[model samples]
Target: MGKPTGFMEYKREKTKEQPPLERILNWNEYASRLSDESLQTQGARCMDCATPFCHMGIEVRGAAAGCPIQNVIPEWNDLVYKGKWQEALQRLHMTNNFPEFTGRVCPAPCEGSCTLGINEPSVAIKSIERSIIDKGFENNWIVPRIPSHRTGKKIAIVGSGPAGLAAADQLNQKGHSVTVYERADRPGGLLMYGIPNMKLEKEVVERRVNLLQQEGIDFVLNTEVGVDITGEQLKNEYDAVILCVGAQKQRALHIEGSESEGVHLAMDYLTGVTQSLLDSKFKDGKALNVKGKDVIVIGGGDTGADCVATAIRQEARSVYQFGKHPELPKVRTDETPWPQDPNVYKLDYAYEEVAAVKGRDPREYCIQTKKIVKDKNGRVKELHTIQMEKVLGEDGFYYFKELPGTEKIWPAQYVFVAIGFEGVENKIADHFGVNLVRNRIQASIKDFATNVPGVFVAGDARRGQSLVVWAIKEGRAVAASVEEFLTTSVKA
Candidate 1:
């Protein structure tokens, strides 16, 4: 729709990034925006297929296959190509409330499902999206839309993460009084703490939260729902309640020295560093400092990469990342075919820094931590690891097989476990009397309504840990459900 021959004319290109070594010197965003001409060229590459799978918003193998928010990719791509940036921004907002967050953090599943990607590189959809919203902010196109009339209904959103914020935004737009509760000192939940600043700056999150405040939504910080206030009080006070509390129970590492002073959870390490950076700009030395120390990061995911980057920034003497699974193929394999999210190898920003400064990548594949040896003072001093191989089991599945004579030990002064999370904490769910299926809150897929009347669930609390895009999608959908429930209940 952008241009019939646009795909044939323009090749795919993305924004450039600062050199890894130069970027590692500070805690700021490394990727720079592309020029207008280049962005327009990238937008022109959209084929606008008869059936654009890029915005279908389906799930494949527990991962998003396309834009979960079902963004109007082709329409905005056309507007950007024609230099109608404001119009492009308008189209973007129709589906997504905060494109800035998704633009920075989303893995760009839309590109993976692009029709052009069937053969050549896909159109630069994510970059175009980032440019459009950033341009909107520059031109002052984003502003609070205060509802003219009130519905005389109140909604309580427990958790200020993406899901809770999105739900609050939608409900407020419909003229309902909405309040968001955050247990942290600040709002934005994972966006504010769990993620490091280098990947997504804290100010970016604050900007959106500020706009929500101006739009008539109330935010109560440092107040948890189940603890500070009784569940009965919330149920009696509000017309309806929505739980967006994230699944943040970090999985425990049962290794020998897990409780050592120097061993910490990845979330705690990241949160402490970010909080200290915000509070005193790191001058207070309140955060975990790993300077001149050997660091070991367990589990190889985005969180592990972030931990590695953070330690490097803190001037760690050395950093090592251990991944249980073997490295994936550089190219897409038959296991993950075309038009799906491929499990191909990629050098994320943090790993790039490790390679640049250390003169080699620090990842060790097919490895498992056996124990964390502690010094006399109860601090981690060494990490024992074992090499692993894949072996077929009786169930006809391949599993990690520990090799007999491949034990090794490395000097480690600090250890960060970045394995993952278990599920939503049971306290809040039990307090609210909501059922749990496999530790996740049980809510009907049809309308997000829980087993208890007028109680709803969304995002990680309901669906387990997932992408930010999915959280936003769930937020919007759950808002509609709340609206329907309110209307029908009133009529009855």
Candidate 2:
């Protein structure tokens, strides 16, 4: 509520991005920050309505509608609108442990639910949030607040993603000795590897991890639970264990020639490229080379887009992406009215990059792959696909019906399946005797406690594939539950 009429005075101004052509040439973040003055103006647009839905961390249409962590949106916006940046940063950090990560990667559901969005463009809350945290870092306002006292209780976290990290941060604040175990050579889980470098640079991930280490959180990398160490060992050694292992098991394609040499999983391919970039800067060699080859990416979600962008950067001859769903409307429809997550079409960075370099958008809607054509040497050579139309079935649901005579083939030397994940891998949960329903650990959200006492779950491990914001929320909530469990046990 900085200005009563601020919404009328300022139009929403989005952060600028480097041109696709120039940005595609490098693996750096392309989005540019707005000037401090411009951001303040954007902050002014926060109507700060009496019933603000921006901070209502609740479910809408079976999905998160606002900030999952319930960030103090209006208060911070008012702080920024008046140039009280230090106060804004402090308020922002009160709930969110990692604003920097969400500010870059989150889809900003807060904007969709903004009061002004009913008629006008919503406030640029995400960009303003990014600016607040980035300024805090630039001014060295972010430092480890070491706990003044230590609790003898010890805890073990099974993953090092956002959920695990947030839990560690929160539990450490309670003076508990916390150690996070990551199976990968590095922590941050998908944040470090699943996401491409251009969207969220690895350096940013490293900086946060280093800060966590400096704050006295112990990290045990290259150590996986249920493999390197038994689940019984963890239960015997630590007072409590929290599992935050993310949903990483990628959905697989089951068409013919699926085992061809040139076909690969999207994460496996993306991970290899990133590891190579970090190790040798892609000079010596690459883990999976797509140079001069026609690349076809299946699944048209963000991961599919990342595959397209990565192939373009690898200098692929051409790229194509297939989506099983029909093309989304350019504007929000009645099916997804205002205040709901908009199901609209807008060019993402990778789509923009492909269109710029190839002179055409490489996406096809209502398409399904029929077969993966392979060369004589068993490498993927092309893809056969067919167009589909939605037909109402007797079950009262629309099903994709293949349109005959619409089959086509395209040259594709490399194929990457970018379909979404199924659920959490079962090994760790099984080892710990935790029940899993639908590949997610069976833990009550009310307490975040599993069937096994002293065992808990959070993030994708408990909720399936979800946004980073929700993961952080789950982490913080689980930390509180762990604290309560520890206190009750000590009293007994």
Candidate 3:
């Protein structure tokens, strides 16, 4: 425990963002760091509960209830509170491979389950975590641990996302050589591109990747398996293969006029913007510009928020985000009680920018895109939408019925569809002769073995779209299973 009565004495505080007007001019991270003294005070709030449900890592009704990676929350929190950050970093790495990413992006389920949260504001577990890793870097304490012994096995990890990276890290530490393959020019998977720059700086990703490289992990980039390299070649070369490819198949609008020029899928548009930034070119050459366009962002999850933020920075004349659900409550709602991810509302950075520039928040709740109206030249000119929403049934059962009699049109020169993703593309899975259950590649929780020998599945490719924490957890678990299979060699 950090401090005996720390929880009672302290109030929750968080990092602040730069002024919206100033932040919108470019793509740079906005959140300011909590000072060292403040962070220590926040860390002392950990109650050190007897049960510590925060790290139990259990599934409650098919949703994560605690930290998926079962992070040693109390131990690290206490260490940070005591200002022993080097030891804290050691404690953190025992479970998680990348606190930096999770620190930036994870929704922080651990805080929700915190004992302090039973009635009051929880300990700033996430902020404490971020500080620990930052200290690790500042002190140059993070270093590669080359395994002392060798299992004489090789593992090939497909996709360099968090899952794949986690798997490789664990397997390598267990004395097996691992290689990660990425299709993109640079690695990091979704972290490299799907997420915008203003939230997570690219330099943060590269610094960690450089560490991985120094650790002797081989990265083969600009290579697409099932295209550049055959699946059979991979099976013959490595003792085991793991797929951490995420769910990237973006869901589309079946509504009319979707095929028009300016109507683009969210991922496709995001990818283009990111790629252009990385490549330093746009359609006009030199500077990639979405400037002066009236952008309409569809869907209301984090991706939608990201799209809104990205467009604002690109100098869009106006931006509107259409969410099918009604506005979330300002406080936790009855439907989502304690320990569930709170559906409470706080304006994300993007929404804040939209408000600063446009005189109001850009979100239009309970609105569904009816159709995309196009100009004579086949470019999107406007969007037709319906203001309808789904509500729970009063009869104590599951219900999702749409409300009626709400439709309107808004001028939109560019449309970015930010609906969520489906499972990974099945072509490679089918090509490898692995069986898929439902949409994802099937593997029991006991072990990540796929239908084919020497093949395993983990992360979003196996579990469908999910959090990065879950991906890392699955990766570590799967790595152990693959290690056992190769080491035992039919011992059973």
In lDDT terms, how accurate is model 2? 0.91
- Candidate 2, which ten residues in sequence have the lowest lDDT sum? 335-344
Tens-digit lDDT track of model 3 for 250-294 = 888778888988877887777777777767635535433569989
Candidates ranked, most accurate by lDDT first: 2, 1, 3
Q: Residues 242-304, candidate 2: write the lDDT tens digits.
A: 999999888999989899988899999999988888778887686798889999999999889
lDDT of 1 by residue, 1-492 (tens): 687898998888857788988988999988868999898888888996898889989988777787999998999999999999999999999999999999988889998889888888888998999889988988999988999999999999999999999999999999999999899999999999988998889998999999999999999989987779867788788888999998988998997889998889999999999999999999999999999999999989988999999999988999999999998898878877767887789888888899999988889999999998899999889999999997889999999989989999999999999999998998998889999998899998799999988889999999998899999999998999999988877532
- Candidate 2 runs further than 4 Å off: 490-492
Preferred candidate (TM-score higher): 2 or 3: 2
TM values, all candidates:
0.98, 0.98, 0.95
Candidate 3 off by > 4 Å: 281-288, 392-405, 490-492
Residue pairs with backbone overlap in model 3? none
Model 1 / residue 62 / CA error / Å: 1.6
Q: Considering summed lDDT, which 10 consecutive residues are worst modelled in model 3?
A: 280-289
